[model samples]
Target: MAELHGTTDDRNEGDASRGVDRTLSAVLASGALGHSERRAKLLRYLVARETSGEGDKIKAYAIALDVFGRDETFDPNSDSIVRVEVGRLRDGLRIFYGECTDPDLWTIDIPKGTYRPTLTPPRVEPVSPPQPAHLNRWALIILPILVVLPLLYYAMRPAPAPEPTAPYPVLRIAVMPFEAAGDHPNLEKVAFGLYTELSLDLSAYPWIAVVSPLDPNEIGADYALKSQLLWQGDNLQTNSQLISLPEERLVWSKSYSIPTTVEHIQDTQLQITSGIATSLGSENSISPDLIVARNARNSKPNLEGFLCFISTYRYAVEPTRTEHLRLRNCLEDAVDAFPEFGEAWAALGVLYMDEVRFGRNPRPGHDSWAEARAAIDKSLELAPLRNAPLMAGVVLSVQAPVQDLERARQLGRKLMELFPRHPPTLALIGSLISEFDGRWPEGHDLVQQAIALENAPPSGFFITPAFFAALQEDDAAALAATAPLTTRTSETELLLKYLAAARNGKTEMMAEQRVLLAQKDLSSDADLVEFVKNRRFHEELEASLTSQLEAAFLVKADE
Candidate 1:
């Protein structure tokens, strides 16, 4: 009889046929049939079944048993073997289709119910004849040359190496505000006079960055410098003093209390300023008498100017009109006494900006912007590269005639580079970026680094970490981070307690906060505003605490 071919007569012929191609292809590809001979035999058996197509379900199971023989019972119902083989077969078909271009040579089809194969003649396509070997000899030789040329070029080319990095620059410094400690009423004034004069003398040095005595807190305690002059005084007697630079191993130990008379004060200040310059090995030493005479000539010595510096520095940390006025008066006197004081002018500019920011100084009617610009301009003229003047420019760029975010960013970056590990610089930049620029994560990181550089001090600095943490909405983290420093019985602690309790869902903690608020006499809106401004809690917490305290106080008043 001629070879019989399979027909799709059963209800599930397509399914079976599809499964057979997939299964046979899988078994052949898996190398799981022990030998190539067995694999080939199994494939042949599957193909034979496809072509015959005469087996009923029972006949199919019997054929499977016959192929396996009695050595191992065949299992038609075992899903583990069938699924694994089917997966392999599907993968094989995919690979074949991917590699083969002509579909007419042979095709694998899975119909509905039958596992079978059918043979058909291959379709042929017309093609051009191959060229003679002698005609292609030169082409073959040139093909190798083309391939080798690329290889040779690649071998000869140099591989690029990474660029070398530059080392961090070294910093120089000088410490000031070496106020004397003493019992004599005027002794402390004399000590401060010495500090001021010495600082001025040191400022003449082109390389030295004189540490201003205006606010010791803002400059930070930790700094690396080649030299430092620590001017300290005995609290009991200003006449007794010690001027020392631990790095230089030098000390100017002295005891001389001058009366508060104008002459004595001038003489005292002159002696110390010139003496410090000589001790520091300065080539040019200022004479004590000249220093005294010069100070006497400017006898007022701009106390207002000094105060302005202090007020501006304080306002930087905690802004207020009272402080602004204090700064204005000081700067005015400072400018009068010393027209060349660039820092004072810069500070004046910043003070005006503060006024404008707080709405105390109007824009159109008030000449605050003009005053600020003029002051900053004069400051820059005097000290072109000074940090104070540069910072003034940065402030103006952000708050004055033009708002330049890029300039502000550049100034901040340069400042940090010049004064690495400077806490106030870091804090200011971090706060600006965090609050105005919407770069919260960077701001938060910068502020946290600033706090770390500050050595985690218990004072106003504690609020840095707390503020950022609250902004991030990580109240528990904020509480834990701030717990150690918030122990002092101040507004800081009260705020911390309130936030910790509020976040922890502790009603009792809130009640305790109420009690503390009452004890501290934080009843008025002004007092509350100050408290809120100085604390670590967020606005929501501040509002909640204010309301709770108000209610609790009201009830107490009724009783």
Candidate 2:
């Protein structure tokens, strides 16, 4: 019977492979290939290798030899022709799939790092368009009912018996159901939302493994996070605690108050969730004491990877060539040790891009852009929905040597669709779209959404709005926008201040800004102009920035 099952499985896979082959033939014949003989041949060779069960063995050397007529002397390190052609093939496949109306067909992709093609069948049904706001009122009407049923079911279910403690270098923490401290309308829903959202936010940190429906047996998780929600006037307060399992020792605790209006219950939930997640996982904002202690006691590869990521984030905050090289090596090691770590791959991509930004690509003959693109692609493939990978992809698409405006827009759309309320993605993508793509109105709307989402956004978030105000010659508006960003010491911040000061005719302030900018490396007129141009500001605003920098430099030169 076992042999028969194996035979049946193999037969099914064979049938699928045949179907995929047919689909590939159809794609090749279609106009989607656009008469590119090279792309067509490349696709054919890759599919043939994959269908023959030699996908794992497919390599650039093999492709160059078989398809590109490269001699045995072909060197993949020196010659990027194979990689270039494969990229075109990927673009061709994307076009084909975009035009493909057949939902039943398999989609082919030649993922980075290898020439083997992956043929994946569509697993998800197309989502139907959402009903209008008036129609969605039905969902709101039934929302309380939906919320109560789940609570009732959970309350009645017998508690999971505690299991034996599981060993771990990677710690597992369970999120138990949040308890309500007092009777309040919709308090049950709020508690449920906290439990769900907190679990999701904590899981964003790749080093920590999160388990739900806490097993009392402690079989999988070493720690448990508990929360209590209560009403305080118009505000909702959430008090959270983390306890070591088995020992039942309190490890960490925090209290948060969120103003909850009738219309903003969801926002209240997000606020509470974000607070807890940041305190527990964000290494930069709040020291996650538990994670810090655990890693100090027993430093493991995954923990090291997380630490490397923290270092990477710091480099973003305060960039230096020394820190850049160190982070590059650290992330490279982390990825090599644990290839599946998506955060590490994302950070590695960022470091690669930073090297290019600072004009410090360490490897002489290698293509850093290609390396960055590959690392970013791998990260997205590993963790598509995560903020880090998405942000890295967005950065690459816009800031890399070869900008992909379409890809940037696609990533931006995904961020808005999946994480509409996420402030970091909103602010970063909004700024990029506005500054790089010149889609100011749409981008500004996203930036406003981010501002509304977070009370105290970082100074970077204000750059685009300030620039826009300056462009319109609204000096007051520009100064008001730049006020919050005064504490920042970056070149960009100094440039913003210079622009605002110049607009207001504050000669002293403008001189101070120039001095500050010079300290940050823009010392001369040529240097300032080049720096502004290197920023690749949108075409509409580039002339204004160039003119401003040129004028400032001329003043200093005359002085």
Candidate 3:
């Protein structure tokens, strides 16, 4: 590392220091680096350390520990998190200063191969010859008029009406009465039964409103789920398709087949209905997919409130500071515009809880917990049966400072009884019990059932199995369980792979996992421990896993 060098005698050190401070603040506030909180924090930390005369001692390990929350076990040789962030920081500073309006602003730079940041005071520009005295007077007179005319026009003009708060129209899905291909006496009854069952099952989803026995010309429904049943070689076959009503486009289609028998009749109905509900309404389902797709091309203001749900869904998938702020603002606006929108309130509650968990609070003294509890309360009061509010209440009960695991369990039981066919709900509650409460076999069974119910299971459906496998010390089973998530780079996926590899003595694979884990902004073993803690696991499992990881990876906690 290099020490800070003194500037030339052209300006006093005090002037240079003040200029650097101003420049740092401007860059930090600027949007040149997009909204990456990691890069912003890195920039601020580096500048603060350099200015405080700690530049020479600013090693990668120290940077990781202080800025990135790494523990003492952080090994600069193995972890590239510090180096990768510094590289990005260097590029971001170049772009910031390159597009700067004030070319004379002092800039901070982390030179290649060194963690120490160098501050370069802006060079003095050659002075232009003074304008003529009459030209300066005329320019001063014109400039005031230019500014005052705009201000006076604004002051004189009538204030426009506030944009009407358009109610967020929940996406409506109508389950069309099914048509029968065969003329069996029971076929019409079976088709009607399927329609009724499917509609009732889909109503459990919080994201969409469900309607049944839809008329083909229904005006309000956004999507139509049409199904047809027939006898195929002594088996009952049900075919279904989801169509976007406005565009009349087929969004998704599927067919399910089951043995034809008196006992199999209800099971067949359940099979087809669970598939449709999971495909259309579960997490990572077609509803959010359609909303995101449409919102990409359409920028009308009416749907902004509607898009808040989509923002929350996307943020849950990939949590970045930018996404968090965007979702938070969107949800806030949504609730403010329509206080009675219980779903939006529920989503807002979830967002607040996330702010607490992720440490993404917008400012000091934000009291995210209080905000979450209030939002949850309002949502429950308004939409008690809605999934979002119910789930939010369940989550808050467990995670808040005054823990209520029993209340969470009660809410989980209520969800299970209410929405037995809802796959994501089942998986979530199952995983919550298994991981948070350490109820192993029972919770694991529920997740397996959820998997069986889903046509296209999400990665979350497999997490419980992986955890179970890891606990059993069956690394191969754990790896196989998480195979569907091979392409994902989430911290959970990396941690699972690391655990599997480390436990099985797979040095080559463990090293590969370490390389990726190192890039997750986690500097040491304790950082991973904190990540696990954020998952809100049961105390027993958390302590056991922490110890196992420490021993398996040969990493020590910071003293």
User: Compared with the true structure, what per-residue lDDT tens digits does model 1 show for residues 1-559?
Assistant: 1232433233254544554455455445433221223224534665655445442322334444544342245555431232222222332333344444444434443222234434332344569798788879888789899999999998999975744231111112234444444344444443444444444433443222244322222222112112222223321223323233223333454555543443554465566545544443332232332222221122233433543453454455455456567567768778878897777788888877766554443447668878888999898787655556667777676655456768779877766555444445556677666544557667765665444332223244445455555444665775554554444335555755655556655667556775775565664545655655443233454555555445444443443
Model 3, span 1-559: residue lDDT tens: 1234444435765777788889887776654443345667778888777777777788898888988788999997566567656754664565567556677688677755588888878888789998878798799779999999999999999998765232122344666767888755445444554555466556554344454422432222456788888865567787888886656778778787776653455455455556655555443334443232110111122344644554455455457777678778888887887777776788888888877675565557788889999999898787776566778888888778777889889888878666654556767888888888889877886776555333235676778878777677555776666565563446777787777766666767767776777776655777888888776678877776676678655732211
Q: Mind sharing the TM-score for model 3?
A: 0.47
lDDT of each: 0.49, 0.66, 0.66
Q: Candidate 2's residue-wise lDDT over 264-378, tens digit each?
A: 4444445544554554455323334333321001112454464566455445555777777877888898989878777679889988876666554467887888999999999
Error of 1 at 503 (Å): 3.4
Roughly what TM-score does model 1 have, to 2 decimal places? Answer: 0.42
Model 2: CA > 4 A from native? 1-301, 318-322, 358-366, 554-559
Model 3 residue 162 CA deviation (Å) reads 58
Note each model's CA RMSD in angstroms: 27.1, 26.8, 26.1
> Which window of 10 residues has the lowest lDDT sum in candidate 2?
291-300
